[model samples]
Target: MNKPVPPPRLRMALIGCGQIADAHLQEAAKVDSVEVVAVCDMHMDLAKQAAARFRVPGIYDNLDRMLAEAKPDVVHITTPAHTHGPLTMKALAAGCHVYVEKPFTLDAIEAETVIAAAESAEKKLCIGHDQLFDPTWLDCRSRIAAGQIGHVRHIESTLGYPISGQFGAVVAGDPRHWVRQLPGGLFQNTISHPLYRILDLLPDLHPRVEARWDRTKYDFPTELWVQLRGAEITGSLTFSSSVYAQRVTRVYGDQGMLEVDFDAQTIRRHTAPKLPGAFGRLEMPFRQWREGARNLQRNLWRFLKCEIHYFSGMRNLMAEFYRSIQQDTEQPITNAEMLRVTRIMDEIFADCRSREERVEEFVPETRELEVVR
Candidate 1:
């Protein structure tokens, strides 16, 4: 009997050779079903550097030329948030499947427009919600599905961003940075990571939003609190630049609770104590210690197997997306979920702006009284 031949790999071209671009390329390289043929950036130097580093054959300063000459089957847009809408539409129009990085677009309207274009083009579209596919998160989802945590009632997702860090410093230093142009500014660029996790659990897209935006650590608003109320599930989000960097999501359920730490790639499950009364209360600390040890062992095992890394989620998401296109199946992320996340962000930002205006109005009157005194 003759062995079967494998299908050809999908040709990929990456646009926007910025800080995030390298991540996309690095992860995609691990997916055997895809090959990056070209890289493009407005700055010729950036494009050249990326091509040389990745050993890609085609390099172009213009997107139109790259799309025409490279003739790639897929396009990865790792550009700034503002250009996502237009660039995605262009790629879809060129008849290429798109894997665009999040904040899918500036707002829900732009998201809808780009999604509609992808539909019209009949190409698969995916957002860079890689954390949703991380190994630890996958394990959490499995336990939830197995009813370990029954009937999820609430979720709290918090993200810590250090303004003095590499990317944050760039945005904080330049007032004219593209990120500053976004509606929600830094929050718009990042909160999508935590926001989508909540949307995945919500029963419906329409959620009542309440938010507070305050600037405590920087001139720009660096602290945000958003509460989302769904039909049965409620969620709260915290994004702080002043705190120590961390990414954690706590899920509350009727039967038990689960806390997932993205940075440590660990999860802890809490349930009713085994013993009765005071003994049970005392036993809780032991259970916590055991869980921590288990997490450490799991991480160590993964490390030994060469399965642990920060971009593991991105690698898995890329492979799934490639397989979906090759097998002609549904993409891992639904357009509805993407739109829902964007719409929630829109509401939160709008509410924050209204609150800021009210504060501005009150502040001037106080200043006038001080001048008279």
Candidate 2:
């Protein structure tokens, strides 16, 4: 007997029709299991344009109206930082799973509120710290677990880029707006990725941060230094927006080191010496390794076919949200982790406000990393 096939698509609603929203639309279109049924934006014109481009039937200037009309199973919020929590709460209350843009909310309190709302509603709430969804991150986790570099002792990650402020200005479309008012800032946007990544990789670590910013000396501080603690490792992250685009992460251990360029899709490892050398030095030979660019290019091509790898990590996250909701299971990236990241952000901001000149040492309570089943 022939069996009936389940429907391939799940209905989706987009709550913001901005630049990031377009990336969502493009990616959602490629996933055979999802359909964008409607779009809403504060700007009606932008919503209309997005709907037309995505071929969604419904468009609205109001989120409530859109939700009432579309009744989508998934609601994606790509709104500005401040509006994320409110919109997510509203969506969850309406019995819809949510995928929110980065930073989740402006502060930890807002994140807690939304998380509680999602729990009460029994709907899934996922943040868009997409870097965790990257395959490179997955591979990194696997290697770390296998002790490929022994015990991870320190980590250094950085992201920087040349800026005209044109992209942000266009998105905000208001010269005096806060998003536009701050040019080349890491706190508001860029640091979210590295912070989230660290939390994801080192789940047991609670980071305490001390940061300094000088607006007169540099555009938007342009640099952030963070020290993190874990049961088995202690790490530091330096993020800067002033230099040309450079993204790299180095994981060091007692035995050796592993370096990854996420953007470049490359990984290199240095092994410990198996034998002693003349000067009592272990003489661990340095070896260069690369994940052929062609392989990375091919994976990227496959990823782009569905707009998967775009926007840092949203596509993979949306898939996980769907699975979590359907299976009624806890997601790998949880509200607890998000809250921890928020706390770290808060510490950084508070430290910046104090104008502290030196890094403050913090001893974190160590909890061992449980092996993933």
- Over 254-358, each residue of candidate 1 has an lDDT whose tens digit, in order, gives 999999999999999999898999999889999999999999999999999998889888999999999999999999998888888888999999999999999
- TM-score (C-alpha) between model 1 and the true structure: 0.97
TM-score of each: 0.97, 0.82
Model 1: CA > 4 A from native? 368-373
* Highest-scoring model, TM-score: 1
Clashing pairs in 2: 130-313
- Clash pairs (backbone) in predicted model 1: none
Q: Lowest summed lDDT over 10 consecutive residues: which window, candidate 2? A: 359-368
How many steric clashes between backbone atoms does each model show?
0, 1
Per-residue alpha-carbon lDDT of candidate 2 for residues 1-373, written as tens digits (9 for 90 to 100): 8897755567899998988899889877766678889999989999999998889998999888988889999999998777788889899888898888887877888888988888888777777777777766667778888998887777767766444465633433444555533222345666787766666656563555556654423424545677777776656667655566766777787777877777766566766556557532434323331335444675678678753353545667777777676667997578887788777777777777666434222212222223332
Model 1 has a clash total of 0
